[model samples]
Target chain A: MNLREVGLRDGLQLEAPIPLAAKLDILDAVAATGVRRVEVTSFVSPAAVPALADAEQLAAELGRWPDLAFSALVAGRGGARRAVAAGMADLEYVISASDGHSLANARRTTDEAVAAVPDIAKLAHDSGGRLEAILAVAWDCPFDGRTAVSRIVDLARRAVDLGADELCFGDTIGTTVPGRVTELLGRVREACPDVELGVHFHNTRGSGLACVLAALQAGITKIDASAGGLGGCPFAPGASGNIATEEVVYLLEESGVDTGVDLGKVLEAAAVVERAVGHELPSNLFRAGGPNRPRGRG
Target chain B: MNLREVGLRDGLQLEAPIPLAAKLDILDAVAATGVRRVEVTSFVSPAAVPALADAEQLAAELGRWPDLAFSALVAGRGGARRAVAAGMADLEYVISASDGHSLANARRTTDEAVAAVPDIAKLAHDSGGRLEAILAVAWDCPFDGRTAVSRIVDLARRAVDLGADELCFGDTIGTTVPGRVTELLGRVREACPDVELGVHFHNTRGSGLACVLAALQAGITKIDASAGGLGGCPFAPGASGNIATEEVVYLLEESGVDTGVDLGKVLEAAAVVERAVGHELPSNLFRAGGPNRPRGRG
Candidate 1:
């Protein structure tokens, strides 16, 4: 399984103002864990999400490792171009499928965001970095209720048609279940068989792992998760925490799905985040001390 | 989507010594919520679990309501006999599928526990109460590891042949996923076409709702849940919090699975337990304030 760590970008984006040194240190530490992909930061305006303003500084200090894919979230052509200039080799852009969230979150409509995807993809491609488009709230929008399956399918087609290397669907509201996941996957795969399908699940409803299980059953191999389940939507009130990365590995490995991630290392990264964020992570694996921790004898 | 609230028996068993009057109050409050079934208490020895020592006393004062079935967990023949004397109409006897958990949790081997099911069922039948056998650690055991699918299937057969009216699979250690649930159900259903199947899931891994989703997809109608995600295995370290009753209803209802449980009423009942337990319930629905709570105008 290809597990992408999104704690730095999506997770930290919701957290308190983290120091730049801590960001670089955390990014370097995460790279050491052998999870090939990490969404390092967002190239958006610092005023909106000040935590990730040091995207350039963090990417500049991002240590190189064999087969590591360092990526950043690019909101539009400006962020995409900035990411290219920042020495990033992979880029991911966010586009909410729900127009209401698109406006509430980004001050843009769904169509406006979709229109920007192609130009962002062009900039990423022209700058020699592969681009992936994340359909935020693809399954549900906290402001608009559930997003339609047909809507996501159409967006997948449009994103791919514009030259996205991958099309990632996100249950931004964390209200998705297996039925919804299976429903979306069946339609999306049929519509865009050539696209690499991925999903981002939040543990808000405690259905994160279930959604992952559903996605895995539907043959999705790429997943975006936060170490210690650290990410949440800032715009969506009460929407906190993504599916923990260790949880994804735990569920997959427990079910004999090889995630190729060391759970202990992930837990260690989680501990680092706990210290950086000054709070305990909400991840079950983080709190439970994992399955293989030594138990004290009475 | 039949939800059996188990806060009194399974949840309170792990909590601090809640007062008998408080227990009775919570039971009555939960009953008023229109939930069809509630596992009122356990008939185990007071020395073993002093919290539920007032089982018979509470049973005597149980408020009657139309179509409400109050049940109790009976450890063995003695407990079953005690429940019969107490006027319980439904009795669920627990047997661990994993040998280690069985010995550690109940001081018996798997076969010894299975052998006792016959007499217990006979006692239940003689007293005009139906019997159900719950295979604890049916999917995974903390003392042991994952309980083999075959083990639970064989236990299901023996319990049914011994006169159990229903067989319930329990994720005693909170280590089950949808894949494991689906695997166990397909084989259990095939082996016992005449018996009813149920499951008890804990949210220890945050996959409780997912496990319920899988079970429902596999045609399981009866589920055991604790109100407010209470309950934990005393012997299993870090295994705390069962699947929340309201979460089960919320998940099912959101997906069109009619639970016949009023979300508003369940939340009201959760509040009563929260005050009695002296802590805010950790259920998603409880914390999220339900799907219809008023949003701020600001």
Candidate 2:
């Protein structure tokens, strides 16, 4: 059970502007949890994601944690180059399977996003940074409605051909069910057997954990979770972002999966982000601790 | 697959008061969905559930839908009597398997709730009403924390011995995962072979649907859902209510299970409730629509 903490990025994206110091503090706490993969920030311009305006600064500061696998979201080729130049350990490039969200959010069609993967991959690889191609809105698109398995499979093939190291299918709008996750992951597995597959889900419609379970059953090993279920879908109206990291870690650890994460530590870090954002984060595990989690009783 | 729509009662319980006419209209729209079972309202004190204060009015009006299996929640012996006297076709008697939640929420211990089941069952039977005893807080207790499965099995046996026609286990706080649901349902099946099992899951922790899928695999045929994902657990802090009916219907229908519901009509009703509620409900199919659902080429 490999877990990627998405708090600094996804959690921050959902809130108002935070000081650059606060972002660094979140990174420092995340490092304390020993989470290897952390999506620190997006390389989009300040105009796009104003919260991530300090992406360059945070990336430079994150250099101190040399052993960590720090990633930055790259929406396009330009962002990919900027993120690579900023000394990111990995680049996560997103392409929506749904044309509506693709065109609306990324301002590029699925084909266009797929078309940029090779260049983006080259940009990351040239800088000694790994690249992961994410098929966002892979489950259901608010504009086009439900995305077909064939479309996701085709996109996975295209990204793999473009030298992507990993393929991730995202329930970008919280529109996926367990069965759909199972079916789509099965197709992605058969079509791109050699590539690593990751699962990203939102808890907007309350199917995030269900989708994660289905993905795990379908042989997916990587998952992305926000610290406090923070981020909202930029494309889908009223859609919340990724599942909470504390909740996901609690679920994984309690199920006897070796997540190598101390859920209590994750909850503590979640509290830090929760306080910095000045709002209650949407993670249940943080509010309701685990079965064996130490309360004041002990 | 059996889908019990709980929108009329559970859906309206948590929010600001909608008018009784609006409640009737919602129930009217739900009646058109061809759902075989519908939990209409609870006969609790109006002070406790202001949203469901017009329970008698709703029950009187619901007589027009003779084809639907309309049920009412009965918290105690008096609530059971009121539901039966109102001519409800089915009665749901809720008791907490955990001593803490039962004492805090229902003002009774587990032993006391178990003792009242026989009287409630008799009252329902005398009025020609079917009975289903729900073991709430079956997964975990809000006040006492983790509950033992053996205690839940003992409660199930007692409920069954009291002439209860069916048994339902609730993931009251969304604490149940797929593995736990599988184990609990399997134990219930072994202990009470003659009783039909229903799984009630809250999406609070985002594991409701996963637990539902596990229950289905464990041979539980009856599942409960609310329209628009309404209601929150009073025992479990910050917990969301039951799974969304539209999402569940979508999942079942797409997987070739016969839920005997009109998917489009349910979505229409969901839209009506979404408008009535004055906020966006957390139902994916209500917003995204299923892959096979026709929305006039968009």
Candidate 3:
């Protein structure tokens, strides 16, 4: 039930400009809710992700929160170097499972992406930072038909061998169900028993929480969730973002899994971001209020 | 894995005006997909539900789908009479388990609602129609904080005693999670072993499909879903519709459950309804397309 709040990175990636100061305010609020780990920003091109142009500034500002561990997203060697330079000692690197999305998104074949992993890892190690590899579209690929379990396992094994601190899989476009999640995670567990596994899910097709439950059952411990489900795939049109943090926390706590997040306070933080965004964010708990809070009051 | 499509009844209770002609078209599509049962409409004052104003006409048009057992929703004796008179032989008589919703929606206490069920059952049965006593808000009530399993089971027992042919429980407002679903279904199974059970769920809080999986594991053979997720709870503000039919069919078929519905075709029908409503429907399969279909056709 230990979940990483990914809203600042995943949620902001799909939106318009969010000031670094406003994002800092969000980070401060999230930290107070007892969510220790937060993916703060991605070191992608400012032109590509103008919303996260302040990645370096954001990561630098994060030095103020000594109790919280903040990470940044990086897609390539250059981005990894930038993330390290920005003072982000922890990095989540991604490569797509789908051939079409892989070529279109990162301009590389699967093998090329795998080859880049070691280089990125080496750079991170030399820079005194750590790297986590996340294979996107690990279950069902929107551009390809079905992503083979063998392929994802191979990627995970290679990533771990290449010095990845953790291996996370993404249902990039949310096409996965519990069966697929269990099947893939089972394979991952069998092949790489010692590596920590995390699941990153999108609620685009609405199987996000179901996938979380499946991942938990399959013996995986970590999950990636957005606050208000604010991220969508920049490469895949119509693709939505990661699961909401509030929704995930509610599910985890209700199932007797300890998420260590205060639901009411998290919802309040989500509300602040929603108001800052000028439209309702996709977080369900923020909209519906928490389990104990009355809907219309405060 | 028999799915009971309830879009016309539960889905239409919201603001979406799935036209009567489109309703029949969707019904025809559902029947063609090999669904065994479809809840066509609720025989209420058209004033309350202008969407189903042509309920009588729609039912008459569905006479040709002999294999699809049509059902209608009824809240009281008058609605039951209207359904029977319109040639619907199966009436789903509903009462909320929560006293607050029972009093607000039906203008009766929980006890009074239970007391009235017998007469309504007799009226429908005397007219050669079958009655299915539906217990709404079975998992968690939006009005009355948390509903007890004993209260639901007792009401279910009394309903069966009064001549209910089947029992259906709604995850009203979509507050149900997998653990809660397991506990609630276990209570019902313990209380009424022989009673055929059905599940009606909403996707308001994003756990509908997981709840469906839990229900299936609990040995529930029947489920309720809406096409394109058109329903909303008037009492539970901001909640979405029932589980989308396309998404449920995808999950069931992907998981090796024989739902007997061509999920690809179901998405086609969902697309039509989505277009008719002049807004993109919330159904995952409709937007993401089916897994087996060729990758970019959708």
Give the winner by TM-score. Answer: 1
Q: Which candidate number maximizes lDDT? A: 1
DockQ metric, candidate 2: 0.21
Docking tier of model 3: it is acceptable
Judged by whole-model lDDT over C-alpha atoms, candidate 2 comes out at: 0.76
In candidate 2, which residue pairs clash?
A: none
- lDDT for each residue of candidate 1 in B1-298, tens digit (9 for 90 to 100): 7789888888888667788878867877777777888888999989978888989987887655546788899889899888889888689999988888889878999999989987898888888889999888887676777678888888899889888999888877677778889999999999999888998887766677778988998999999887777766444422357788877877788777787888788878888888888865566556556654322110
State the fraction of real interface contacts model 3 keeps.
0.24
lDDT of 3 by residue, B141-208 (tens): 66787888889999899889888988999877667789988898899999899989989887666778
User: What are the candidates' interface root-mean-square deviations?
Assistant: 5.7, 7.3, 5.9
Candidate 1 Cα misplacement greater than 4 A, ranges = A233-239, A292-298, B233-239, B292-298
Give a tens-digit lDDT track for model 3, residues A23-61: 988888888788888888889999987988888788778
Residue pairs with backbone overlap in model 1: none
lDDT minimum window of 10 residues, candidate 3 chain A: A289-298
> Tens-digit lDDT track for model 2 on B105-160?
78988889889888888888888877899898887876887778888888899899
The candidates, ranked best first by TM-score, are 1, 3, 2
Error of 1 at B106 (Å): 2.2
Candidate 2 on A1-298: residue-level lDDT in tens? 8889887776677467899888777777777776789888899878867888888888889877776788889889889878878877589998888889889887878898889988998988888878899888787776898788898898999899888999888877666677888898888889898889998887665567777878888888799987766666333322355687777776776576778877667777877886787765555555445434321100
lDDT, residue B255, model 1: 77
DockQ of 1: 0.31
TM-score of each: 0.92, 0.85, 0.91
> What lDDT score is found at residue B288 in candidate 2?
45
